[model samples]
Target: MNPLPQNMENALTGSQSSHASLRDVHSINPTQLMARIESYEGREKKGISDVRRTFCLFVTFDLLFVTLLWIIELNVNGGIENTLEKEVVQYDYYSSYFDIFLLAVFRFKVLILAYAVCRLRHWWAIALTTAVTSAFLLAKVILSKLFSQGAFGYVLPIISFILAWIETWFLDFKVLPQEAEEENRLLIVQDASERAALIPGGLSDGQFYSPPESEAV
Candidate 1:
């Protein structure tokens, strides 16, 4: 063919250069992609390393809270010797404000247990722990109404409830095992992008190029 126009030749050369680059990217190894995912997960876990320490601190405070309640119960109600005198000063755990506090404590325990389970990659453990914690708290409430009139007896469940929830929220972003699977499914999108970049038209979907595979996918 006769010599093409200067601009058309330049455009064709540029297109060829771009196509070569895209092909280079599309030849990526799947193993490398998986390795990148593992690297990211390791870094993410490091960021949450202090979750256990936080749980311990909350548990310590929870214990102190229970002890304080016991002391208050003993002093306010005649040392548990006189039942009639004890009734007069016992702060009713069932009263609206106290009831709300109990619920809050319970929710906190749920949070703690959930996070702990997420860290362990055991969702069933989380569910079982939550059920046991709830059941224990419910039993305490029932026993308090039936057998004891004072608030001291109710403190353990409240403390347990608080501990569980504190555990849950500690690592809210810590992905459970199932969530990791779901997340891996999205990783295919990254591979597709890389393949598109080295193709003749780049990404025909009008998508932008993915960075080097070494970069976080």
Candidate 2:
């Protein structure tokens, strides 16, 4: 019998071990496992990119809607009158509304950065942004009488707060868990490979049987 190449036997053994190792995959040896992880990671990140696009779209819409509400509030609070009288309308009182849109832009940017640059498995960036947004909105509601004027006051801040919280929750619950699980799988496969490398021949004495070199030809 011709001697089996060490590498070929290893691949066969890897496929066999997949059942007890990675339930969703075969090719558990280091080289193949690394290749599989690289491929899977690309697809995974592509999926995440799509999700990021969706989230960014929502955040953009929130900012625009908040801006519209602010514009409406301005007109309602004497922007039209100031224009007719040729006097500048004092917008400083409602400047917090502008901050809301700015913070929303910041929130979405940080989200992309955390994943693309930091590769973070936690929601620290989003959590911080959400905290600031929530607190600011709360203070705006409490200290200001904008609600007394119309629902625009409460609607603007409330919707912004809700959207911010939603993004934070998504990063913490959905994104982080999935990424961490995949990473853990990859690490386990790598550890198994390193351990296997340290062992002697990955075969029994009976498996070492082989024909002469000339006969194998």
Query: What TM-score goes with each of the models?
Result: 0.38, 0.58
Estimate the overall C-alpha local distance difference test score of candidate 1.
0.52
How many times do residue backbones clash in model 2?
0
Q: How accurate locally is residue 83 in candidate 1, as Cα lDDT from 0 to 100?
A: 36
In the range 1-217, model 2's lDDT, one tens digit per residue, is 4556665666666665653453323233557756766776776667564444555566567667766766676577668555323322333444435556566667767766776556566667777888888887788777776666666667777878888887777667766666677767877766766665565444443433334233222
**What does candidate 1's lDDT look like per residue over 1-217, in tens digits?**
3344555656666776786665556555555766766765664666443444465466446545754564565556556445323443555544212432344455446545555444555445445655666775676566446236455555545666666555454434444433565457557645554555455542442343433222222
lDDT of each: 0.52, 0.63
Which model scores highest in TM-score? 2
List RMSD in Å for every model shown. 12.2, 10.6
TM-score, model 2 to reference? 0.58
